[model samples]
Target chain A: MNESAISIKDAALDYPRKKKGVGLLREFITGRFKKIPRKDRWFRALNGINLEVKRGEVVGIMGPNGSGKSTLLRVIAGIYAPDEGSVEVEGRITLLAGIGTGFNQDLTGRENIKLTGSIFGFDSNSISDMEEGIIDFSGIREFIDDPIRTYSAGMRARLGFAIISNLEPDILLLDEVMSVGDYEFRKKSRARIDELVQGDATVVIVSHSKSILQSMCDKVYGIHNGEIVTDGEPDSAFEFYESEKE
Target chain B: MGVSENKVLRRDGKLPFLSAPVKIMQNLYNYRQLLKHFIGRDLKVRYHNSILGYGWSVLEPLALTVTFYILFAILSDSEDPYRPLTILLGILAWSLFAKTFSNGTTCIQRNSSLIQRVYFPREIFLFSKSGYNMFHFILSLLVIIPLLINYELMPTQQLILLPIALIMILMLGTGLAFFTSILQTKARDVEHIVTIGLRISFYLSPVFYPLEMITGGRIPEQYAEAYLIANPMATYITMIRSAFTGAPLDIPTMNLVITFATTIAIFWIGSIYFMRKERKAVKFI
Candidate 1:
């Protein structure tokens, strides 16, 4: 019970920069036959990051564009293996990034719920059990049966948020999803997230919105140039973040 | 407290070679529901708007069979009565391999959005593509039933080879898919090369002809066994055709054994290659 929900130690991830035309082709062919020394090719996305999230904690990650905030979440979610160091997580974890992640435009909103649910490893019976709740929460009843391509951006985001929130993983990773939808929808989602956080779910929210982080996060980490520049209470973290911005 | 129960990921952590397959099977079993959803989505998205729906699955191979049948009839003096049946079987089996390979290679890139945001077994995408094509192959096989009835061919014990041939083809196709899907993410040219390779392999394979054309005299008798061992698809298609036409499985025992062993080797090697490159491949995509 005392164990942290998520822990990382000195994790680093690097992505290769883009190469055009002949150089890429040569690299590709050589890469197949031999391990061409690629030390110079990689751009470090996460640099020696160390983080720990206690159970029932609400953590916020604030960073500028290209500052490795998303990559850090992905590593915790197990979508990317760090190039160095280690990561450990207890309990089930789910990362919901962007609106309508993996929605088939041709499928109706009702069907896409089941599809996305299964993508999270939920069985049919459980997904079916949660179907009505998701639909009710999204409040897109009339358009639920219509293909998602016909739904507006806000409607798609609403449906997407509804499905993930209902699943209720032990650890939730949110990346800029709260920035979408209308003001009313945002308030509703914020309340729903509060309920989960209060019920002892570990939450990690990555956003550029300073006020949202300050109000919601128990602790905020400000990342700059793929490294944490500040890790403290929201006020101090924001102070460092604002100074860096100027 | 119970660190053993927690999931730990390290850069150098890898399951031993002997246990890798067991671990993969366990992972696949746990995510069976996701695999089912993926396969269902593939089927729906493919035939959703088509007028004929699943009927097109049968029609495509049938049309190809007729075209090949006519061309062969004009090109040669052979009056083989089971020509159409064998061609259809070959086309169906070959399409399963071709579609699985070509689609499997690009599956990672095609599903890059889901791959980036979600964390399920990436192998599910490749299997779903194979399963979708396998479903079409089975549907198309139903077209051969009437041909069998017309020819007065009864279901023989040889029909048992059908599933055996299927597993071999699936193993080879899915195996190659596992390897290439990762590579294709890094180099887009892999797909183009696979396309041209499949086109040439169609003629090299016994899709529109019988194995007799090679074993009889076209290929030197010394290299006949070597040919079968080199191209496992030739043996697989021949097994499928013989199962339907009740033609004797003329493949030698040693040749069959070697081809089956080679097929398994390809599957194993491809899987290992995929596992090693998978983490790196995702970054490139």
Candidate 2:
């Protein structure tokens, strides 16, 4: 309904922690009687952050480890609700977080394609239509009938990327997924990702690689200690990130 | 862009408890395919590496029936033509309830990887296990029913109640499953506790022996009603057995009335408890 694909105002999310020396049994027994034990600590993963991403934009989030990069993505993906504020999003979003995150190892590549496609909301007819293309793009047509356990890690990544990129998601969320497959497939995947982003689709990518962010993102946000320290063009964000590293 | 910090937390983002039934139904409709995938995956994984595969479904309960059949025969010092059939029916009913709760307890933990990655409703895991066990339970029935027909153990009039009894048992089992599954996420000991409870429950229910053994001579007449009413499994077992063996329903009408009420009540409470706890339980798991 709105041109902005994602809008967040003062959104905050906390990871709860149980107090030390309190056994799980005590917690369970007390919880059964409607007595919730007080949380000893609340780690703020995302804190008082405000941002907006417009339609058809590739925004990259560069942050150090444990700096809330993944948590921000999860909050936007509706996996975790913000504790302090609200997030409003429009469009169908698909998140590719890791290599083969949802695949069943015992299922064959072809069957897994069907499973993954259906989970992403594709009907049977569409899955059948995209099956051959996914296999062809992965270049593992010969091994498509074998169980996914037999595939190498790079091969699984190939298949995962092939299926995800083919789904034509409205908003694509990528979390350091470019560092996958061999040299050749990685180059091919980069080109494929470029093609996907070139469409009228908004993309939010999280990567630590400055070169990738500089080459791909229109705007880059540099985060440190759970706060956005730099929000500007890619070159300036990368400079801020480098300056922070020193 | 101008932005203001909102102080009041809007709990309106989530649907209220009264809409739980409608929410469950809508989720079932929207993620019907995902549910199917989960069931299909669980079934395939269970049978894929096993030597006997589907045979185990029938053989498991059948083996347990044989053990009890022999134990009862030796202990009671009597020969009954329909003894094995009666015991088989009891085991079938009890196993369905036992397996659903036991498996349902670990459904969330088993799928923790998927839970961490995706954003689907967590109850899908519990229902998947319950649905898969139900399929196996129904398949085992295919084996038992033929033996029943061949032996001519059919109680024609009471046969109408079997479907109703089976549905009630399913509701009760799933309800307990929802409650325990949420608890199990927080404390791993819930599974062990449930396993022990089901074992004790099996003996308390009328599995190997008929209700007559308990009500006739084993206990005082005054305490019989309370005993039977306390264990809803006993009522379900009797209902199922009477459907085939023409045995008289020993429990009172009040007990049956209470059993039905408790069955529905447990399901309602279980679903509400699961829906509320599941969204937050993922973090603990």
Candidate 3:
């Protein structure tokens, strides 16, 4: 067995812009009534991108906005299917993006924790066991019983990070998660992530921060125009990305 | 790297139609906990901060029943004993269908935020929204138990049919929902179309009035049976009413058979359509 945590072979994904209501309706009416032909518009988000992560490696992906970073992550998470090639992921996985990735605003903080935990494939007993730790880490004791809509953005992000960081998934996909918190919380989050990586959890993170990538990732891949342009150690990849940006 | 190793997860485009039904069931079972959470979220959000809370679930149908009773009171002074009970039964049965359909159609769009964040069975969104409505339907039945007792409508062997009728409504509502929710994901106009269609369906079916009004005299004799078979809601309401009040079923036996078959067909077809559409639909969202 190769013991690979993630694998992508020549993956490509595109989205259709002209297949929605107005476009479809216009085409239908034209074809049936007006006898006209219509063309469809397409946007290719990921193009022939191939990468793999071994069982215990921490890899960071960096790219400019709209360069398909999130799209690639989504593809690997099985949330979006690649238009070409294939993606294979082994082990339990969770994608943690911005604050409140799966929290319901109307639910109490406690309720939201249970809900998000279940959605992440945690059993009820596991969620119950982690309840006190999550609440304590979030430090939102007063509002833990209040609806999530009442919490501040910082509070919500704190709660979200706390719960996600506690989960012991074999694979973790993080999308710019460290950008949300204050300095102290970010430090705590970094420590928690370091602990997970130390415990042999495979991690893939996407971030715009070169410093963050250089600090945490064993290998870094720089993406440009929907393809990986640089792959190597953190310093070399960051250097290549910086020169390309200039 | 081993090229032929078994991958734990793979996203091949478009599953085979033969596997769609089984796949949907598998996803439902795997995501049952998420479905339960969503149901709880729905019920809590709906009743939170309301003065009456869960009482509104019972009161809404009861109030509608009273309004229709008053309106129908003017139509004829026939002195039929089961009129009010039948009317209540019809309203309750039809609302279950209507609420589930309306909520299920828009549920995917409503959970667009969650869709982008996680990958579970998308149908869980549809089921959870309808599931709470089903819960409300069950709770409302409690209110009617007193009414059933007050009217001395004791249980008969036919009472076994009550659960069957309710299950039929759930299947039919969910089937229509799966179809509409997929369409609404691509086109917002489907929502408006569904709303208008449902309203017209309410009028065409025997929700506010008795089935006798149509079968007895209004329409020509030959078309009456066709009309009942054409509108499954009317047949469903009649069955539920017959089960509860022990009234003779005005609906033909063949009509019941056709309705059941049609409900199953729609559910199967809807599952097929939804699974195919769901894979491509996430990108649009």
Candidate 4:
């Protein structure tokens, strides 16, 4: 009963750097004769990292660019398999990264809702049940039938957020998506997220916005160079983060 | 509250060979809804802005059939009345393999955005590619029915082999795709190499000519069995044509068995290769 909602222990992932000017033909001819060292070929995006977020806990991850924040989130979401260690999670996880992560641009907003809903493992009937709520929340009912490509960036973000939020995911992973859309939409999205958090859903947010981290997170971790620099109250994490920046 | 079971994500260890395909099939079944949506999206997006839409699927093979018909008519003195129908079937069958090979190679890279953002069985993209092309293949097959009627040919027992042949072609194409899609993500050149390989295979396959040209004494008769077994596409295309024309299958029973086994082996090997390489390959993509 005390099990954490998300547990990542000693997780490490390497991003393979592409070989320059290496074609399959050249590799076929020379591969037998050549022995390229594998050690220098990969850029490790996530180092040996351990994290635990208890059930109903709201956690924030703050880091600079290339600090492996998104990669860590992806590992937790099971989008990337770590080169070492493991990630275990309880409950249905939903990750909303940017404007439209899984959207088909050619599909209308309405169609994308169904498609994305299905991707999240929802049956069509449940997707249909949430369809109206999502459209109303997005506030783009007039353009829901138009192809999503026709929507503005804010509109697309609103639609993406609406679809995911209405699904009521048990574990929600947000990767810098809260900064999207205009002031009003952002306020509405924040309210909805607060409501979800109040319902005891586990939440993880990856962001550089200090205001967001302070307001939404119960605890914040500062990551630098694929390693956690601070794991404490938001003020200390931001203090370490700001010092690292200097 | 009860402790819910935790789902773990880690680097997969080597899977036992027998369980690999079964595990993949189970994963696919679990994601069947997404697969359906993907296939539907593939079909809809393909024909979205085009004027002729689905007609384009039939037109390409029909145009090829005509070109071959006119060329062979001028060159050869004897005419096989089933030449046009046979040629159309060959083109349709070959295109299924060719399109799947070419498209499936790039499918992973094409959907990199989706792949990076979401976590689902990556095989869905490859399967959806083949599934949608299979849809086109079936649609184009319907066009040949009128031609079959024009030739006064009705359904026969041999037609049972039609589905078998089609599935074999699909497995072969999907198997090849599974290998190339992962490789293509690592190196952009794999798709180009596949394109060249497919071009050579088109001339080597019996797309324009009858299988008889090869088996009917073009090569020594003894090696013909080996050739059919070696090149399952030849056996499949020949089976498809025979299925429609009701010509007795010229292939020996043993060769058919070996070819079927080879197709399954390729599919199995491809799935295993895909599952193994996919995690590493996505990093490069």
- TM-scores, one per candidate: 0.92, 0.88, 0.92, 0.92
lDDT of 1 by residue, A133-239 (tens): 99999999999999999999889989988988888787888887465588888888988877876677889989888977877889999898888777657877788
Query: Ignoring the other chain, what TM-score does chain B have in each prediction?
Result: 0.93, 0.87, 0.91, 0.93
Q: CA lDDT, every prediction? A: 0.82, 0.77, 0.80, 0.84
Better of 2 and 4 by lDDT: 4
- By DockQ, the better pick of 2 and 3 is 3
lDDT of 4 by residue, B263-282 (tens): 99999999888887788888
lDDT of 4: 0.84
Better of 3 and 4 by TM-score: 4
Kindly list the interface RMSD, in angstroms, of each predicted candidate in the order they appear. 5.3, 9.3, 6.5, 4.9
* Model 4 CA deviation exceeding 4 Å by range: A19-34, A231-235, B1-16, B47-51
**After best superposition, candidate 3 residue A179: deviation in angstroms?**
2.7
lDDT per residue (tens digit) for residues B1-285 in model 2: 001111111221764376665677676776777778778877887677665777876787789888998898779965556788888888988988888888888888777766666566677777777788777777677777777888877557887667777878878888898888877777878888899999998988888777777777669977888886677788887788888877666677888998889888888878888877775666566
> Candidate 3 residues A1-246, lDDT tens each?
667889999988877655444435445456467643332446777888889899999999987787888888888888887878889888777777775656777889999888888877777888899899999988888889998888888998899889888867778888885655688888888888778867778899898888778778989988877888776578777887788788
- Please rank every candidate by lDDT, starting with the best: 4, 1, 3, 2
- Indicate the residue-level lDDT of A65 in model 3: 82
Which pairs of residues collide in model 3?
Answer: none
Considering every candidate listed, which one attains the maximal DockQ? 1
In candidate 1 chain A, where is summed lDDT lowest over 10 consecutive residues? Answer: A18-27
Compare the candidates by lDDT and give the number of the best one: 4
**How accurate locally is residue B280 in candidate 4, as Cα lDDT from 0 to 100?**
82
